[model samples]
Target: MQELAERAGISGRTLRHYHQIGLLEPDRVGSNGYRYYGADAVSRLQRILLLRETGMPLADIAGVLDATTTPAAETEALTGHLEHLAQERAALDRRIKAVEHTLSMRRQGREPRMDVMLEGFNDRYEEEVVERWGRDAFDASNQWWHGKSVQQQKEWKARADALLARWREILQDGHEMDSAKAQEHAAVHVEWFKEIPGTPTHAGDTAKSVDMIRGLADQYETNPDFHVAFGTQEAARFAASALRLRVRRLEPSSADDLRG
Candidate 1:
């Protein structure tokens, strides 16, 4: 047992704990009260050590071991783990490159480029958007954006800023629940949304835009930075409601169609 522990670079107590947890049981106990591990025990110990080094929780490791029926199954699981590790390593490399690029730019007294600061950020959001809305949804949005000219991109961004400023002003004025200005701002917002090439449209109606506005409101409630730009929760709610009402008025055909 001592020799095995030394070879495994683990203490006897750890080996004993593994045995207790059914991870590395000893082959047998000698008459003189010594624990003897067989070849199978050594293999199990090696697997346990390897999994631990990979940062898997003990409970998860036990579950994985329990689920493994054949050598092929174990190998498949290991390969999957390796793939995950490779992705993590790739992300780390991107971060490192971003940092190095920024450092180089700073050393040369030049402004750091967007590609430097946004290395891993773009992929994170892309993956999330793709997972939630399918590859076609992302591809359509990407294609639409790629087809736009630089001047058109600037115009779109300016329009978006104008819409956001309108929302902020509506909140700042303490507009009535049923105010004309609030409704007008909402109308403008919906119109701006319609002009966006990749926006999802149903029968050319934006009444379904209510759900998206509500989601943004919910996010604002938790994110202070978002709330600060949009004003208070009450204001955000009012803005969302106004937008929904305006969309309903503009697209009466789809107004009756509730979002699921």
Candidate 2:
């Protein structure tokens, strides 16, 4: 047990705790009263450590292992986890590059461009919007957006972050697509739309509020930038469905037009 624990870079007590939690059960109890792990156990232990290193919670790991059965299912789960990790890694890489660039500028006694330092952060949101709605949509919005003060822009971005964070939390809680909370989110989303200057006018109707909301949700579902922001395609779809339902309930005409 000690040897195996040392090999795994974990203490014997930790290994025993894993067994207690049914994560890594030993192969057999020897006549000498020692727990001995077989090859299968060792491999399982390695997988657990790999998942841990990738920042998965112990409980989530247990849930995933319990829920996965076939090799195909296991592979799918791993693929999803890997995708999430890859996104996180990309974000980290951007931050690293920004820091390096800033350091190089400082070494030359020059100021880094604040815009460059902050580029990828806001670009992701705009990229999602443009990709889903089209350059014309963003161009229209940008005309109104360029009028905003830097402080106002910062405020808008903070609100956007909060909105996305709430959506993520709702998904993490395993909320239903058409739940009351989702409708509330849709309502806040409508208000967010109103805050944007040219978006509502771009479609040319105040009564098309619901259509606008549903359209944005559809965009969120199909856009890769939006999928990353929301963390899962299912979550994006759920938000879209909920927003569509809300639109139907609130503005039947717009909903009908959009659905048509």
Candidate 3:
């Protein structure tokens, strides 16, 4: 076990923890109580580490490993992980270039352009938006966002943070999802949604906005990241329910037609 741990560049304790959690187990255990791992164990350990680098929870990692019953499946999963890592690397490179531009401009005694100042700070949700809504929608939204000044962008982000914080506090206070305050909060959420540049709400299309709100409600309930952001899966579900109810109440004429 010690040799295997050393070979894997992980401590013996971590190896033992993996064993205890049924993540990885030794191929054999001697009568004297020492554990032994084989070459397969080393390969599995490397895959586990790679998945962990993608921020997958241990339970999800186990599921992914279990689901890869064949070499083909394993290769497919690893390919997906490689794509994710590549995107992360690209984002970091953009951020580094943005910072370098800022520093160079300062050294030259000139103000940095808004584009240079805002690079890499925005678009964390670019991939998610593109996947959910279509490339055209994402492109329009991204273009609108990049056109804003740094201060405007910061103020917009601050408003978003404040809204999330308010929801967190409201959930922590044990308020019911359909309570009056919760509905009011949902109204504010929709109002905030209207301020975005590329959405249907911004275009004064009430029908499309209703559809978007319903889609958002479903996303809040189902998206794992939303659960993480909102403090819990249950909290996300609550927010979804509140938003759905508020949308139904505010746009009763279109409520029946709103698609999830």
Per-prediction backbone clash count:
0, 0, 0
Q: Write down the lDDT that model 2 would get.
A: 0.68
Q: Compared to the true structure, candidate 1 yields what TM-score?
A: 0.48
Candidate 3, residues 34-152, lDDT tens digits: the string is: 99988888788888998888776688678778886676765676677678778677658767877998899899997664431112224655676566555666666666775678799
Model 3, position 149: C-alpha lDDT score? 80
TM of each candidate vs. truth: 0.48, 0.42, 0.46
* Residue 170 C-alpha lDDT in model 2: 85
Worst 10 residues of 3 by lDDT: 113-122
Tens-place lDDT per residue, model 1, 1-260, is: 99999998989899878878777779998999789989987887788898889876677677677786676666766777788788678668657876898899899998664421111114435685466445655555554654568698677666655665677677778886458998777656655544433334422434335544445445545544444445455655666667556555655554543221
- List the candidate 1 regions with Cα displacement exceeding 4 Å: 31-33, 63-70, 82-162, 166-260
Q: Where is model 2 more than 4 Å wrong at Cα?
A: 1-140, 201-207, 253-260
Question: Between prediction 1 and prediction 2, which has the larger lDDT?
Answer: 2
Task: For candidate 2, write residues 116-156 as lDDT tens digits.
Answer: 11221133356865655556666556545555676986887
Model 3 stretches astray by more than 4 angstroms = 1-139, 253-260
User: lDDT: which candidate is best?
Assistant: 3
Task: Give the number of the best model, judged by TM-score.
Answer: 1
